[model samples]
Target: MTIDLINDMIPPLKITDDATKALIWMEELRLHALPVIKDKKFLGFLTEEMIMDHNTVDAKAGDFLLKGENCFVFEYQHTYEAVKKATDFDFECVVILNDDNEYLGVVVLSDALSIFSQSASIQSEGGVIVLSLNQSDYSLSEISRLIESNEAQVMGSSLNIDKNEPTKFRLTLKINKIDLTHVIATLERFGYKVVAKYQEVKSISNEKERLDMLMRYLDA
Candidate 1:
């Protein structure tokens, strides 16, 4: 859960704190923005730019109009939910609150992305298959069965509406095996439209190895 990724190192701004104090904290912490709270409840985010624009050495934190007041997620929510909220609000971090709506901590964008890169689907050796399907024809269970019959498994999958064709959608499946020839043929035999396929390198040994493989892939 996202609660596990909460970053408690960055302290929140107190409503009574002045702009001078906020600016100092921002510089020391190396963050562009910090959350403001009153009585353990989140108010909003205060940015360095907001403070600098005011040009007040002693302006109270409460005097500024903070941003991302509604940009938050409960601690029990999924990590992807935090990512989605950050994307929707265009905030660098997402505030986390408990069931009582009290501030818990914030999840920085970099940490969240790091967790995703280490996920099984992204790190494991695999091949990606992109299929074009009608909205009504989409069914993961059916697709998985077909892939399984070909001695392969769907490690992960994502769906998106085709912008060029509103009536159709694109399904991207990440297979655990590097060779997708059998899987692609099985899907096509089962009336699935195989639009594209790409093979991936085997499981990486370490961060440096993973990065080296990525660089080589990019160069290719």
Candidate 2:
């Protein structure tokens, strides 16, 4: 599902606002930094540590040097883009703007993470399998076909470059079935190396135990 960027908007601060007020707002909102705007234009971000380091509590936000002025995303951008921007800039939040270049608000890293965790792919009920493969040998269509041959479908998948080997990649797949024995066999038969696997059997067992306890309590 598409994310509504505007709904994640965190209120911004005016450039003329005092650093002390900014600090108070940060404390109240549990934010490390906040965006500074002027005439609906985003100037930059002001951090509590920056103010404390400069001893500029009484100074206006505009009077101090702000950071991450260019660290922003358009309102139409995806939520992942905001997360990426925040991670790339090492910023506490990501600024948002409209098509007209007007300041909208900021998306806090914490909120972005929450949205990401609740995303469909993440919340889907499935078993996860991680595979290590050479870049040249990687073909998504081939992998899907192998999975389908085992009567299992890939629910979702992600890839990351192997840190130790630039020519290799780590592929993570979410499979619809909790039992992945057949899927793993099929992939390995096709020369795919299975690195790790996670199943829902433990969770299912726990749930069954809880249901049994509930039934016993009802009978008592």
Candidate 3:
């Protein structure tokens, strides 16, 4: 659950607080927005741009219309829900609430992303392989069987349409075994085109690199 990912560093702004105070918090925390709470209930979020647009530095947060009222996820919800809310509203962070809709805390997007990168399936020591094949030829069961024949299990997999070819798809798989020499040969013998492969030796470095690339992409 995302409850554990709640960031205590992001203090909520009271409804009575002025926009100037909100701006100060935003600046100090390097955030674009901050949550507003009243009597333990989440009112919404106030953005730096919103304050600047209305020139309401001295106005109380409740005085002006707030944004991202729905930019929140229940504490027991999956981390993906938090990521979805942040992305859907272009928010820097998402408010976390309890079952009764009471404010708990906020989860910064960057923090949630870091946790996602460290998920068991992602951090597991494994070899990754990307296969390019026609959309019509996709068969996960067959693929898994072939991989198992090599004494390797498919830990996880993702399929996406090949950006360069409309009719082709890229199937990326994470295998349990670090040594993929036999796996690759077995796949190729079955006419599966292995487009890319990442051996286990570089798993640590590659995970860090992937996280860095994702952060850059999000910034852009």
Candidate 4:
């Protein structure tokens, strides 16, 4: 099932609202910024720093420069898009809009992350493998084939361009098994540079402990 975007909505502030009121809302909601809407059109984001810098409580929200005027996603867009926008803008939240450009609400960064962590791929039993490769050599199909050949399926994958090395990319993969020794060897053998690996040891240990407790109760 798809995630319900409305479930993560944060209220908005009208452009005509007082700057002080916006700041109050930000503080009450424990957020650094809030989306500003005028006539159902998202104008921009009102941030606490802007309010503090303006040093005037009586001014309208429109008086200050809003941060994320273009930082928004359509309501029907996947939640991953919202998360990506938030990251790209370093925003505390991203604005959401309807097809008509009507202001819907805002998606808090923390809420998006919480929802993402509960996704099927994340909840599944898996191990993570990070590989560094040149942008030109990146191929998902080839990587998936290599992983499948080793009897392991790729549960999920994310690609990030290396900041220090613009020509290089970092590929993170979630494999369906905790033991990645063979997978690492296989990838290395194919000339894929393995940068890091994360196994599901703690989760497996916790599950085992719970099962043992259940067995003890049954025996008693």
Candidate 5:
């Protein structure tokens, strides 16, 4: 999943408009840097280091007129790409844009990191189990019991929750291989769902795409 956040918005050109106030914004938001955009285009980022380097008495954001490493990005930019850029430059924000380079939003490095870390964790420890069950025949506890009965464990779960004609829940299981066979058998016998097994299936594509995404987030 991409790391997109609405609350990450910081006013465009806040540094130029009021350097002193922008400093205050940094304090309030506890952000090391913020995106500076204009006309929906990601222009650059205003950083805390720059602010402090100039000093409040002698310079404002516009006075120094230097943005954070001249970094920026577009909306379609992938989340992992954003993370890599943020990581490389140590930037605080990755401003997002559109096809015409119109500013759509911003991605906080922390937010992107949060997303990447979560994705990494899930991919490393989670297993996807595709279960085939009728809409009228859905039971979470029974599945849990079967898993536990086989000495397996479900770490976290997410259902398609897509209310299509036939609903499906893709469960994430963290289990020992010893119990996997029994768990599968019990599930099949109990009329519980068992469709496909993404066991130890790393979302490699997600990783690749995300990595590229972070790259773009930085380079763009």
Candidate 6:
């Protein structure tokens, strides 16, 4: 899925402008990191840990913040890349900038995770469809065709070879907006053996009784 870049945006400013105020600003924003820019050019991020590492309030603003040209990404770049890029520099957030190095925004790791959580997950909506078939029977192109036939796009998928036997494999697909009955039919018609389904089975419990039980359970 393509990530929306507009969700990631943070202001840029120099650390030396007011270092103490920056710390308070970060705390107020609930951020552990922030972007540092000079003359509209991207600089490295200033992190809470880095500030604490100095262990000296006597140090000037420049001394406490990250320096040099190592951190920062081209502003229009993909938002999915924040995790990898952040890991490379041990940065809590990566500063994003334009072609001319003008301030664009900053992508906090937490912000990206928030976006991830809010997005639809297949497990929460559609049930998983697993098929036991010969390894040779599987083809990405054909599978894509079958999935589209039911007007559903594959959201996530995984495959595993039978450990006890060779040439037999299991393919698991997560489809979008499909009823379990239809999903089983499409796979079964294609000569795939439906192995297991993990849908939320309807409970026979009454709604009021279920709630009372759950509340008692939580209380216990």
Q: Which prediction has the highest TM-score against the true structure?
A: 1
Model 2 reaches what TM-score against the true structure?
0.63
lDDT of 6 by residue, 1-220 (tens): 1134533435654746455666776787777767777777766666667667866544545555465255666755655455446655666666666778776666665565555444344223555566677888878678768777878777656566754456887766656654778767887888778876654233323434333322221221
- Weakest 10 consecutive residues of candidate 3 by summed lDDT: 211-220
Q: Which ten-residue region of model 4 has the weakest summed lDDT? A: 211-220
Q: What are the Cα lDDT values of the candidates?
A: 0.82, 0.74, 0.82, 0.75, 0.57, 0.59
What tens digits encode model 3's per-residue C-alpha lDDT throughout 101-138?
Answer: 99999998888777757755566777878888999899
In terms of lDDT, the poorest run of 10 residues in model 1 is 211-220
Error of 2 at 106 (Å): 1.6
Estimate the TM-score for candidate 6. 0.51
Off by over 4 Å in 2: 1-9, 123-146, 157-172, 177-220
Q: Which segments of model 3 are wrong by more than 4 Å?
A: 123-150, 156-220
TM-scores for candidates 1 onward, in order: 0.71, 0.63, 0.63, 0.68, 0.50, 0.51
Pairs in steric clash, model 6: none
Clashing pairs in 3: none
Tens-digit lDDT track of model 2 for 21-112: 89888898888888899999998889888998987578998988899898989988766567667766788778888889898777776665
Better of 2 and 5 by TM-score: 2
When 5 and 6 are scored with TM-score, the better candidate is 6
Q: How well does candidate 6 score on lDDT at residue 106? A: 66
